[model samples]
Target: MKQQSLALHETMEVHEMLNLKTVSMTTSKMMEGVVFDQDLKALLEKDVQQSIGAINDLQRLLKKAPKIE
Candidate 1:
């Protein structure tokens, strides 16, 4: 039914959001360590930003989707 579909979508949205937040936090913490050099840090930061941006875009799409009810 429409309700079930909406619930599934919402669940997926939350899962993705949580995953993104985790990745963001982990990457941020990793960056705090002085082991990595500037070049590597820049590359890693870019990847983290890309992942966060992708999740944000998905969240935006889910929010914009119209309810079937």
Candidate 2:
């Protein structure tokens, strides 16, 4: 099977998105404890979990890239 590779621009965009998701996860974690509304708190926790999953998936994609210098 032939292997496929991401163009450099696409890889950079993915990296940027990964950074954005990481920042969102960090903010959600910090705010979760401070939120007073029960529903909002639960929602924040869900966002945190989803963000984590997204970061993991993105990291996996980054790992699959050809190790170009």
Candidate 3:
């Protein structure tokens, strides 16, 4: 299979999404320490897990993106 590099705009959008997900995951992880409600904590944990998967996928896609220099 031929591997194609991502377009500049698509690369930028993916990068932005990766950053946002990273921030969200970080926030959720930190909140897990202070959160008292079991249900809320569980929800945050789930979000963190999903974000991790998404970040991994984004990283793989980024590997194919053209160099920005």
C-alpha local distance difference test of each model: 0.66, 0.91, 0.96
Task: Give the TM-score (vs. native) of candidate 3.
Answer: 0.92
RMSD of 3: 1.1
Could you give candidate 2's per-residue lDDT for residues 1-69 as a string of tens digits?
977877788789889999999999999999998999999999999999999999999998887666777
In model 1, the runs with Cα more than 4 Å from the true position are: 1-21, 64-69
Greater-lDDT candidate between 1 and 3: 3
What clash pairs does model 2 have?
Answer: none
lDDT assessment of candidate 1: 0.66
Candidate 3 local lDDT, 16-62, one digit each (tens): 99999999999999999999999999999999999999999999999
Steric overlap count per candidate: 0, 0, 0
In terms of lDDT, model 3 sits at: 0.96
Clashes of 1: 0
Report the error of model 1 at residue 27, Å.
2.8
Model 3 bad stretches (over 4 Å): none
Q: Best-fitting candidate, measured by TM-score?
A: 3
**In candidate 3, which residue pairs clash?**
none
Model 2 deviation from the true structure expressed as Cα RMSD, one decimal place: 1.1
The prediction achieving the highest lDDT against the true structure is: 3
Best of the two (1, 3) by TM-score? 3
